[model samples]
Target: MTADTAVLPTLLTALRLPSIARNWKRIAEIADRDDWPAARLLATLLEIEVADRTSRRIQRHRDQSGLPAGKTFATFDFNVATGVRKNHLLALGTGDGWIETGDNLLIFGESGTGKSHAVAAIGDALIDAGRRVLFTRTTDMVQRLQSARRDLALAATLDKLDKYDLIILDDLSYVRKDQAETSVLFELISHRYERHSIAITANQPFSAWGDVFPDPAMTVASIDRLVHHATIIEMNGESYRKRVAVARVKGKDSASDN
Candidate 1:
């Protein structure tokens, strides 16, 4: 209500401290009522501003990440996906050192075995931990890269992607064995090798990747680079979707009988 208080908002806006600008008045009332020290009040405001900025940054990263919603680790069923260790994933979720060192994460499993969900969950964790991540279908990313190549902007596009701490390519096996498409994919893998992290979900083993990369030699090189410094997780189990479908049918039958 004072002249000084009326000018506080404008000053905060000029300083670009939106969080502090918005909450400072309410917090100051609490500080005064509680008889807090000057240092405590200042520290509290700074902490609120930092936390608000961090939340906004994470939200922005999540929006740009293209990650599927509701696929976070909290919702993942570790019991069904028995091959994946909860402890190991929890450790990886921290993204403590591997992401910094550009280590790759390769997940291999059959369709509907929760590979995509698992990786997406890990990606979500990395984002929460202040790491930037991009989630895209393997084929979609390859098509974009191919277009970039044709436009003579392939290098620039790759350079732009380097900003992300990790790129999650879902369903590697779905990419057709076309030379052009596969060539662009190979180029992406080669470019990011040892420079950035890539987390890939695949339905096929390395031996079957010859069908993904038309050139056997290219396949070999790609595999070598990906596995050189990677944590390979093999998810082997019945399809989660299949089980859910069966359960739905049983529930319907039981309801009809009742």
Candidate 2:
């Protein structure tokens, strides 16, 4: 109740102890009620602050990652993605220092085969583990990079992307063979080579990548850099979306017959 006590929160705010500043009053009351020692009270306050800060940091990163909030490993139907190995993905989800070493992940599958969902789930897991990530469709990211080039700020844009530990480029097959866009996309791939991690989902295999990049040589170069230290996951299975649609139609037909 003293004037000095009123200024305590202000001091905590200035020191960037936001959690402690907001909850110290209530926590102090609980500590006093339990007759806790000074050390215990201080430790409890710090623990609260650390937990709150960690939660907030994860939330911020997740928000900035551009990943779908509902797309997580828990919701992913592994049975449909039979080609995906659970243990391998679990290991990668830990963000186990592999990104720091600049390893890449190549997810290959046909349309509706859950390639995008799989990589997004991994990105979500990485975000939960305190690693930065960005999720963008292949065309969208390439266009942004292309715009950056026209504005003569491509390097600055790439530098901004470097802030992320991993960049999830969803649907690599969607990027057209536009020389400008493909060049920027290749630049991004080349720039991140052996320096950062990339999780790419593609419908076509490496041999058919010529459709994505106008120049055959650039396509080869991009593929080489991406697969140098990469984990290749082949998800070539029946499309889960098609399977579900077929099941739904069957159920409707059965109901009509009944």
Give the top-scoring candidate (lDDT). Answer: 1
Model 2, position 157: C-alpha lDDT score: 98
* Model 1 root-mean-square deviation: 1.2
Q: Give candidate 2 regions above 4 Å deviation.
A: 179-181
Q: Residue-wise lDDT of candidate 1 within 123-142, one digit each (tens)?
A: 99999999999999998998
Compute each candidate's TM-score over C-alphas: 0.96, 0.94
lDDT of 2 by residue, 1-258 (tens): 989888998899899999998889998899889999999999999999999999999999999999977888898888778688877887888878588898999999899988888888899999888899999988899889989999999999999999999999998887779546678888999999999999999888888889898788999899999989999999977888899999999999999999
lDDT of each: 0.93, 0.90
Report how far residue 169 has shifted in candidate 2, in Å: 0.8
Model 1 lDDT at residue 194: 93
